[model samples]
Target chain A: MKFPFLKEAITSLTKKPSTELYPLVKKEAPEGYRGRIKFHADKCINCGMCIRVCAPDAITRTIEKTEEGDKITFQFYLGQCTFCQMCADFCAKKAIELTKDYSMVGTDEEDFMVRGTFIKKLPPKPPVPPAGAAPAAAKAPAAAPAATEKPAEKAEDKKEEK
Target chain B: MFKKLIEKGIEKSPWLLHINTGSCNGCDIELVSVITPRYDAERMGFKLAGTPRHADIVVVSGPITSQSKERLVRTLAQVPDPKVVVSIGSCPRSCNVFHGSYSVEGPLDRYCDVDVSIAGCPPKPEAIIDGLAKAVEILKTKRRGK
Candidate 1:
């Protein structure tokens, strides 16, 4: 008589239950796990790379022109996100990061939104010329062209004479 | 009296009914794993019910395709009041990548109020457990209100 099953059955009784005590004892998501979108507005250049790479169109941007600059706001709706990490990968500035916080549970729609805002300052305008200098500045280029044209006319006349 | 005791009992064990509209099976697989031995959602008093009438929670996965939209609506209607609707993944919440497709009729809120949304392509088993635990809390309150 083979008692092969008896030894295995007895050892099973000593083995601990595989069930995880999740709620009571929190678990951490593994490293590089793409869970939630974290937008770094300060680092973002607003190049629209993340928006382009997003397959779901979960990323939306609104630009409001203010006295300071163009105020750009980016909204990442987690509800529509695929968590593909494409936005993070395409981001040139590393402004978008996929965090390991996988427990993204919420009741309100707004709760799932990740937003960031940044103001892009306008480039400095070139210094305007004074009234007196303006005429001289314009005349300088006009006179230089006339000076070159006179020499060319003289060369043409010499060629005709030859 | 006995009513309060029965209410408490009902709150302790909330049976779930899973409805797949037109999922890619990613979320469905993750949902099943939550009930497996390793994740064991039963330890928290969550059980999968065969029918909507028996369910205290409705777990909806997938983007609602035109083919499934009617059935989804009918099934949701069958669920009793005080039932919590839990969107299992990005699909049900806003249709994810399937948004604006010709067949998809969802982003589940257009049909009913979503009680809880667990956002992911297919949320981790631990995350599913977390969402389910939150649903149980909401269930307790809804029961007390009634």
Candidate 2:
């Protein structure tokens, strides 16, 4: 039933190349292409969601506070990451997303990690009292009572004036 | 004409070649399933080729990492002309998790042009078959033009 010579010639002549011109014609990638992890540091509220969800414990958040203010530091170790993308999905802050950029390779193990820092401004301090207005001369026990009575008398005088 | 006859022949028998750059092995597994008894991509005249030179379709998985970039490019170049490159999986289209790492050099589009991208961490076998079918259709068009 088969024409051997014609079949062989047709197959040989019709075989198209399997390699795409990847540089010229862009391939339409599928939906939800998980390529790379996109980081939105600005949107991160230091919630520790990404750190907690990371099964490999690849992420760590360090908070530092001083009399001046508070600073949040983030460390993401890609070497340990499983590339599960669970952290990005579970994150409530929407601070992280998986991008279609799968181009990660490093020779040094340490090169895979990333670190970021964020700072918060502190409030100003209250002003100190000026040097001695006679330092409020110490009053005797009896004088203390008189001093308290004087304030009461002053209040009464003000009431009368009003 | 001769071009139409060649296009018809190419549409009848298409060989696929797969490449795993640095993927999580998810897409690779699904691709293997295409040849299994369940899906049996072979029934459609689609067969897996061990070498790029014998293939008409290239199925690529994983993001293009610095380590795999040159090798992928070189291997792909070995494939014949009028080939269709299908990017299968989320990692190849986007970084997924390995994004900001210094070693990443992706978006695949930067390195080479992709013809069809099968989205998913690991696309189902049926989806892959569908994608390949579409690629074959496109191949027919290209052959017609040539």
Model 1, stretches more than 4 Å misplaced? A1-7, A131-162
User: What TM-scores do the predictions have?
Assistant: 0.89, 0.49
Each candidate's lDDT (Cα)?
0.93, 0.72
B1-146: candidate 1 lDDT, tens digit per residue: 99878887888889999999999999999999998888898877889999999999999999999999999999999999999999999999998998899999998999999999999988999889889989999988888777
lDDT of 1 by residue, A109-150 (tens): 998999999999999886778988998998998899999999
Question: Which window of ten consecutive residues has the lowest lDDT sum in model 2 chain B?
Answer: B118-127
TM-score: model 2 vs. ground truth: 0.49
List the pairs of residues colliding in candidate 1: none
Candidate 2 lDDT score at position B99: 73
What are the per-residue Cα lDDT tens digits for candidate 2 across A15-125?
865444332444554677654466777777777878878765668788899655778878766544556788889888887776664433332334455677776556677
Q: Label model 2 with its docking quality class.
A: incorrect
lDDT of 1: 0.93
